[model samples]
Structures are given as C-alpha cells and as structure tokens.
Target: MTASHILLVDDDVELTELLADYLTTEGLEISVANSAEQALALLAPPARFDLAVFDIMMPGMSGLELLQQVRPSNPIPVIMLTGKGGDIDRILGLEMGADDYLSKPCNPRELLARIRAVLRRMQTPPSAPDTRVIQHWGLALQLAKRTLLFRDTPLELTSAEFNVITQFMQNPGVVLSKAKLTERVLHRELTAYDRAIDVHVSRVRQKLSKVLPEQELIKTVRGEGYLFIGEE
Candidate 1:
C-alpha cells in the first residue's frame, strides 16, 4: 500500500512542525496546521488526508470539539493527542469515530508505527478466485468492491467497520472472542479499558440491523464475542 497523508491539528506550533518533519522522513505525507481553522481548510479537499492527528487542548476548538463536528460526516481516519487525562478522552474519541489515540510525549517512532498500522488496516483486499459476493436477505457483501449492498442499495462504511466485518465474515459460524477480535481488527495489542473493538462491533450491528431488519446477522456469543451467520 502507498504511504498515507496525515494532517496534524495542534496549537503547539513547534511540536507540530517538528512532528511533521520527522514523520515526512518516515515515509508519510505530512501537513501541519497550527489551528483548527487551518485544519478545516486543509480538509476541505477531503482526499488530501488519509488520517488526522488532533491535540486535545487548542486555542479556539479543542480536539474533542473538532472530533464531534467532523465525525458526523467525515470518514477519514482520526487519532487524538492527549497529554494528561488521556484515558477519558481516549474513550470519547473512539466513541466519536476516531480510529486511535496516542498520549502526549509519545515516541515519534511509535507515532509513525501507528500511522502505518492504521493505513494498513484500511487496505482493500486483493482479488482472488474464490472471492465471490455473499448475499443474505437481499443484502450483498461485495468483497471485490469492498462495499456492502443493502436491498440492492450500495452503502458506504468506514474502514474500521469494514475491517471488523471482514474479520467476522471470514469466520462465519465460529465464535470470535473479544480478545481475538481486538487483535485482528485494531492492529495493536490489548490496552487497559480498550473498548475500541466493542465500539466497532456496535456500529456494525447498527448498520446491519438497519439494512437487514429481519435477519439477526450478528449474534452475541455471550461469554465469547460475536458470530456472523452466513446463509447456508
């Protein structure tokens, strides 16, 4: 996959510039915005950025504020920057549709690693011989198109949701424990209070239910995590 373009939204000009410079050398296309207004301008051309790094404390608009506003319509991946009290903000960000978060004073190398990991998780699956479309109750999952068609209506899904559903669909009729789901989809090992997987699953269930109201497509495995029931 190609390198991802990142937009850095932070009032810390020095840190933002430095991080941009470092990440550029690390193979990511980096853009720095010293304010939320500037970041919005950059994002106006949506395709320009594959992901965003937002700082929690900024002058006019805080990271959380920006997340709330942008998340409703924007589909680009997001990662938040939190110095202290990151725990609470981390959960909020994920719930608001952020893909990940990194504590402040985080190693630049780790940041680079995370950016890469998120991009990798967003990749479209390769074409193969047995890559047939899966249809159930008038909803079709096109593996080749990387899209979901509900009642013959095509629906767009975020990369995170697609990744989670892909993982579940690949293991139909089998139970997926939360731990395994977290590893397969999140691209990182488990962290304390890591409710990222649960959030993704919830989002998927909401979408699936909306499309297939009669089909209980995703079932809770109780002690385990979830299962995707394939049409037999």
Candidate 2:
C-alpha cells in the first residue's frame, strides 16, 4: 500500500509536534508547518504533499484562507483542525472545502478514524461488475481489469480519471451531470464548489486524446455535463 504524505499545519507548537509524532508512527509521511504562509510555501516545491491537516486558528493567515487560495489550483485533500467547542468554525471549515474537521480536545483514535475514513473514500476501489463491457471506436474496456485498451493497447489512467471514464463508457451517450459523476466517482453528494470532478474529466480527456486523437470520444453538452460519443 502506498503511504500517504500528510502536511501538518498549526500554530500550536506542542500540539503540532505531538500530532506529528502520533501520525508518523501510524505509517504516514508527515511535513510540519507552523502557519498558513509556511504551509503554502512548503507546498510549492517538490509538490508531494498528499494531504494537509490544518489548524483553523493560525496567525497571519487562517487555515481557511490557505484553503481558499490553494483550492483553486491544488487538489490536495485537507482536514481542518479546529479549536474545541467552535462548532461555527467547524461548519465553515467544511463549507470551505475541508475534507474533515478535528477538534482541539479530540482523541487521537477519533482523529485517526476520520483520517482513515476520508482516505478510504478517496481511494475506493473501482472494481466494475462482471459481465459488462463498453466499446467505443476501436477502444475496449475490461470491466474487471479497470483498464482501457485501444486495439488491445492498455491505457494508463489516474484513479479519478479512470472512474469517470468507466462511468461514461458503461452508459455511452448518456448525459451525466456533475452531481451524477460526483456520486459515482467520489461517492459523495455534489456541492456547487466541487471542482474535483472537472479536474478528473480534464485528465481523462487528455489520456483519451493521446490514444484517440482522431476524434473527440467524450463529448461535452452545453448546459449539461458529458457523454461518451459512439454508435450504440
């Protein structure tokens, strides 16, 4: 299993250190940052931060601010750490794209639970049901293998990108809205600010273009979502 690299951002010295030690022991690679500016600066180079754990009360720039600025460009998952009894902050944190929220007096085990849950949802298996296949152009989809093939040549796809393509190919020419795509791929309800699906769609299109450059396989519908274009 691939270990997740988590960015720990907080202004509290003792708490950050303690959390870092505990999370590191749990087989996660951790990078610590004291504030949002520092965290954003660290996120610039290398670009290997898989997730971020942010404290909502940091000085200079708040955790929510950091997310607002970066969420437009970065797709890194985030879990916000809020002060205990601050329900309003917690609600706002989630609204602002925080994947999950942890309270200050949170139990180590509880935080671990939320972390694993979020990661699990993000990494859910895409084992397609047996006895199903969708063919477009000269491309074939192996439902079991979760692989796309053009003339039996396998195509590499990112997890999210693969999920979206799988859904579209399974029901070719079916117009799937953002909500439907999100539910299928992310396994969650769609929010207006949900751009994750769009990112995955862009990536899937790129891969398809590389293999099927002669035509646009996935057609975009005006005022709608997308469709896999091919004769039934």
Candidate 3:
C-alpha cells in the first residue's frame, strides 16, 4: 500500500522536524512547512497531500485563516494543532472546516491516533461489487463518491460531516450513543468532554436543515445521543 502523505505546517521548526521523524517512523510520509504561506504553496494543484496538520498560532496567516481561505475551493482534510486553553480557536477551526484538532505538546502517539482517525473518515471506501448508493427518506448517499444529496440537491459537507451523516443514513432511526458515534465516525474512543463529534453532527444538521427546512432530520436524545429520523 502507498504511504499516506501529510503536510505539517507550523512556525516551530524543531517541533515539525521531530514530528516528521516520528510520523515517518510510524508509517506515514511527512512534508514540513514553516509557515502557512509555504503550506499554501505546497497545496498548489497537482501537488497531492492526504491530510494537513496546521499550527493555529503560526507567525502569519493563522491556521483558522488558512482554513477559511482553503475551504472555499479545496476539500482536503485538516487537523489543527492548538495551544491548550484556546477553546475559541478550536471551535472556530472546526467551523471553518477543520477535520480535527490536537493540543500542542501532545504525545506523538495521540497525534498519530488522531491523524489515523481523520484519514479513516476522509478516505472513501472501495465501491461495493453490488451497490454504490444508499437512499432513505429522500436522502441519497453516494457511497463510492462519498457525497450526499437530498431531493437531488447536493449538500456541501466537510469530510467529517459527510462521515457523520453517512453513519446516520446507514442506521436510519437507530439511536447511537455519543460513545458509539465517536468510535464509529472518528475511529476512536470518546474522551471526557470531547465535543468533536457533537460539532461535526451540528454542522451536518445545519447543512441538512438549510436544504430541508420543513422538518428536523437529526434529533438529539437529551442525555443519551443523536437519532436520525429517517426511513430505513
């Protein structure tokens, strides 16, 4: 199998180097950029990268800014590297289309796990020999293409949002606990107060609501989890 290429962007040269070395040892190909500008240049057309790890406190063009600019045209999965206590930055990064976030000075092992999780959510599965689309209650999921359409209108969703909605579509009315959702959608166990899954589900709901304004599609089961009210 081909190695997954990663773009690591941060102003901290030493950290990027250490991470590159560690990630390489862990079976992922790493590319380093010391600034958001350099990272943008590397993202130019025909230069492929499976995922990006951006530092939110970069010298110029913060990771949030980079995401705001890139999300309009590029759909690459991004994971933000944030300093502890920057809750605002983490939330804004997700709103701007980041796939995940990791606190700075994090264990290399944890970062590796987060990266693998994001890749699992972003990577499209192989086309089934028998079927490629799953449809229920006016929502059509093009599994092979990883796109969702409602009433023939396509929904613009980030990779993470698409994965969350796909899980909902697959289960229909099944009530999925937050822990179960986190494990299924993020490919990791849920941590205390970890709101990543909730944020992604909210984004999906917002997009779905915009297209289907008459009714609520994903309902929160207070104190339990989320339920997708769709026909099986």
Candidate 4:
C-alpha cells in the first residue's frame, strides 16, 4: 500500500522536523512547510497530500487563514495544532473547516490517531455498497460518494461537515448528544469544555442555511443536543 502523504505546516522548524521524522516512521510521507505561505506554494500545482497538519499560530498567515483560503478550493482534510491554552483558536479552526484540532505539544500518538480518524472519514469504506443513497425533503445524500445535493444543487462541504449531516439524516428528528455526535462524526471521545463538535455543527447549519434559506433545518435543543428537522 502506498503511504499517505501529509503536509506539515508550522513556523516552528524544529518541531516540524521532529514530527516529520516521527510521522515518517509511522508509515506516513511528511512534507514540511515552515510557513503558511510556503505551504500554499507547495499546494499550488501538481502537489497533493492526503491530509495537512497546520499550527494555528504561525508567522504570516495563521492556520485559520490558511484553512479559509484552502477550503474555498481544496477539500484536503486539515488537522490544526493550537497552543496549549488556545481554546478559542481551536474552536475557530473548526469553524473555519478544520477536520480536527489538537493542542500544541500534542503527543505523537494522539496526533497520529487524529490523522487516521480524519483520513478514515475522507475515505468510503470498501464494504459500503455503491447504491447507498439517502433523500430527505429536498436534500439528497450520496453515501458512497460522500456528497450532498440540495434540490439537485451540489453543496460544498468538508468531510467533517458531511459526516455530521450524514448522522442527522440517518436519524432525522432524533436528538443526538454532543458525545454521540463527537464519536460518530469525529471518531473521538468528547472532552470537557470541548466545543469542536458544536462548531462543526454550526458550520453545517451555516451551509445549510445558505442553500435553504426559508426555514431552519437543524434545531438546537438547549442544554441537550441537536436534532434535524426532516421537513423544515
């Protein structure tokens, strides 16, 4: 099997080099970019990566900006590394379309786990049937393709966002707890004060609203979780 390629973007040259060496041993091809500008240059043409790891706090363009710029045209999964206490940055990163966020000084194992989780979501399981499809109201979801269509119009969604809506469409009107949503969509356990799940949900809502402006499709059940209104 070909090794997965990853772009590691961070201003910390020492940290990026160390992670590149470590991640390489774990069967991943690591491409190093010491700054977001360089990262963009590498991503310009002919260069492709399965996933990208970016440090939230960078020299010129922050990870958030990088995500914003890349997401508009690129669907590559991104895992952001934020400062140890950068809760705000983490949340912002998710809202900006990051596939996952890890606190800086993260354990290599945990980072690897997150990377694998994101990659898994990026791929359709081999066991998945080709004809799998779900249609709710005007929304159509192609499970195998991991694509969604609203009134036959394709919607641009990150893999994480797509997974979140998939969960909602699968169990429409059923309230889904943050913990359950986190596990199902992010493939990770919910942690205390973790708002990544919520941010992803909000992003989904924003996209959905842009497509269906008349009514609210995702409703928040205060103090509880969220539910999808199948016919809103």
For residues 114-228, could you state the per-residue lDDT of candidate 3 as single tens digits? 9998898676566553256888767889877778988888888888788799889888888999999889888999987678888889998888878778879899999899999
- In Å, residue 172's CA in model 3 sits off its true spot by 2.2
- Tens-place lDDT per residue, model 2, 1-232, is 7788888898888877888889889998888999899998999956777778888888899988898887746767787787766667766665555665667766777666666656765653557446556688887888766678889898866445567788988888789998888777666667654455665677778778987788788888877898888765
Candidates ranked, most accurate by TM-score first: 4, 3, 1, 2
Q: What tens-digit string does per-residue lDDT give for candidate 1 at 1-232? A: 4777889999988898889899989888888888888888788853568889998788998889988888768888988888756677877787788887888887888888778778778776454634668776566778777787887797667777877887777778889988888778878776676677787888888888886777888899887789989878
- What's the TM-score of every candidate structure? 0.85, 0.56, 0.93, 0.94
Highest TM-score against the true fold, candidate: 4
Q: Model 1: how far is 222 from its true place, Å?
A: 4.3
Model 4 misplaced stretches (Cα beyond 4 Å):
none
Top lDDT hit: 4
Ranking by lDDT: 4, 3, 1, 2
Better of 3 and 4 by TM-score: 4
Comparison by TM-score, 1 against 2, better one:
1
Each candidate's root-mean-square deviation in Å?
2.7, 8.1, 1.8, 1.6
lDDT of 3: 0.87
In model 3, which runs have C-alpha deviations exceeding 4 angstroms? 126-132
Candidate 4, residues 124-216: lDDT per residue as tens digits? 677846666788868999987788998888898888899999999989889999999999999999988888899999999999888789879
lDDT of 4 at 194: 83
User: Which runs in model 1 stand beyond 4 Å of their true positions?
Assistant: 1-3, 125-130
Clashes of each: 0, 0, 0, 0
